[model samples]
Target: MNIKDYLESGTLEAFVLGSASAAEADELQQLKVKHPEIGYALDAIEADLEMIAQHMAIMPPPGMLERIEDRIHELKRHPVAERLPDQLRDHGQRSEKDKGQYIEVEGASSHMRIHKIWRWIFAAVFILGKIFLGFAIYFYLENRQAREEVKELKREIRQHHTIIGQQ
Candidate 1:
């Protein structure tokens, strides 16, 4: 029989899986017996599919399995604790006096990071404020110069009118 034609027809899929009818299975067994190549093809397909399945399976890291099991048990026992990951966790895993020190270190690290961020924020505000202040000063100086020019023009006009009156 045409093995290539049979595989292409998708009949081999059902045949390989034993999903074929009893008569079809018997026919496939006879074909396998006649052609060892058919058996090799089936074996290769199974191996390839198994490899693909394994490649797709991404197992979680260590302690994740235990955590997942704990969560499952938690859902059954204490539903409320499941909501809070921090509260449910045991600090007993931590040392006694050192736990406080660790807490302090964590707090300090967080606090320092916060302070550093704030410092940058404050510096940015200060720089922006200085820019605005400089703009205000520039506008103020411009307005003052304009007022002085107006006064000078008035004085010059007054002088010209006085000379005109004298003439």
Candidate 2:
């Protein structure tokens, strides 16, 4: 098997991308040990992928993860259960209020109300969220500007180094 042909066969790209099958991965590992060029190619591909990811990375909205987790907890708290039929209910044991068509659910409240203290807490959370969002935007722009400045400085330093080395 020609090394160049194997390199261009997309096997290495699949391996680096983690899309290769188990058999293909085992073969790639064996080839990587026998050939230094395969290892170098893998490293270059991985670096390219990392650079691409860094360029495409975006910050999610604040509290997104918290909201998702809260929703998951709420769902867990209110799990779906099979309703008992009217005939299955013990009407003799029911009170005046419980004698209605509605079945009394145990461990789950029918009336849901947030605590009065939570109203204040929610307002505080909203105000703090806005403040944190503003700070995040400010810092993100500052960091981006700093990165550009560092790149410019590094380029100038490389040019000076090359000029000195030529002389």
The reply for model 1, stretches above 4 Å from the true place, is 60-167
TM-score of 1: 0.34
Worst 10 residues of 1 by lDDT: 104-113
Candidate 2: segments with Cα more than 4 A from true spot: 60-167
Judge candidate 2 at residue 15 and give its lDDT: 93
Best by lDDT: 2
User: Over all chains combined, what TM-score does candidate 2 have?
Assistant: 0.38
lDDT of each: 0.74, 0.84
What is candidate 2's CA lDDT for residue 50? Answer: 96
Counting clashing residue pairs in each candidate, in order, gives: 0, 0
Cα displacement (Å) at residue 91, model 1: 48
Q: Which tens-of-lDDT digit does each residue in 1-167 have in candidate 1?
A: 68778666656677766677988778878888888877887887788779888999998889888878866865676465444344235534654544444232132122222455888999999999999999999999999999999999999999999999999
Predicted structure with the largest TM-score when compared to the true one: 2
**Per-residue lDDT of candidate 2, residues 80-167 (tens digit):** 4434544355544655655656655554546464677999999999999999999999999999999999999999999999999999
User: Which residue pairs clash within candidate 1?
Assistant: none
